[model samples]
Target: MPDIKCSVTECEYNSDVKCGAPMIQVDHNNVPKSNNSDQTKCDTFRAKG
Candidate 1:
């Protein structure tokens, strides 16, 4: 499995700066061919609250 680094402390799937989920999806379809990280989002993100 690839190592996925995450910094969203509020996400339930985040643990020790890593993703604990079995899988993750990067949704950049809204901004195709974009090189900006801000333009993309983690669809698997789930708020802990």
Candidate 2:
């Protein structure tokens, strides 16, 4: 675990501004690095209703 911090309150795995998921996948468009937060997405994100 990399101690991922998250603030997506609507995600089922988000709790107290932290990620409670067993594992998280950060997806990028085959880029070596992302210059902004919008360039990536949390593949582990699951909608909370």
Candidate 3:
């Protein structure tokens, strides 16, 4: 599969390349549930091993 580049630096799943999971699911609390990109943040992100 092609690499999925993630912009979240703090997420353990985030490397220089793609997310470890085949697909990533972010919780609404960790990431904002709105249209505003500036208000979004993922505090619960973890690397899938």
Which candidate gets the maximum TM-score versus the true structure? 1
Ranking by lDDT: 1, 2, 3
Predictions in order: lDDT: 0.88, 0.87, 0.59
CA-only RMSD, every prediction = 1.7, 2.5, 4.4
Candidate 2 per-residue C-alpha lDDT over 1-49 given as tens digits, one digit per residue, 9 for 90 to 100: 8777788989999889899999888898467788887878898899998
Candidate 2, backbone clash total: 0
In candidate 1, what residue range of length 10 has the lowest lDDT sum? 29-38
lDDT of 3: 0.59
Better of 2 and 3 by TM-score: 2
lDDT per residue as tens, model 3, 1-49: 4676777655677777556555655444445465664556454477455
Count clashing residue pairs per candidate: 0, 0, 0
Write candidate 1's Cα lDDT for 1-49 as tens digits.
5888899979999999999999988888588776888878999999996
Q: After superposition, how far is residue 23 of candidate 1 from its true place, in Å?
A: 0.5
Deviation in Å, model 2, residue 5 alpha carbon: 1.5
Steric clash pairs (candidate 1) = none
lDDT of 1 at 8: 94
Q: Please give each candidate's TM-score.
A: 0.78, 0.75, 0.39
Name the 10 consecutive residues with the lowest summed lDDT in model 2. 29-38
Candidate 2 global CA lDDT score: 0.87
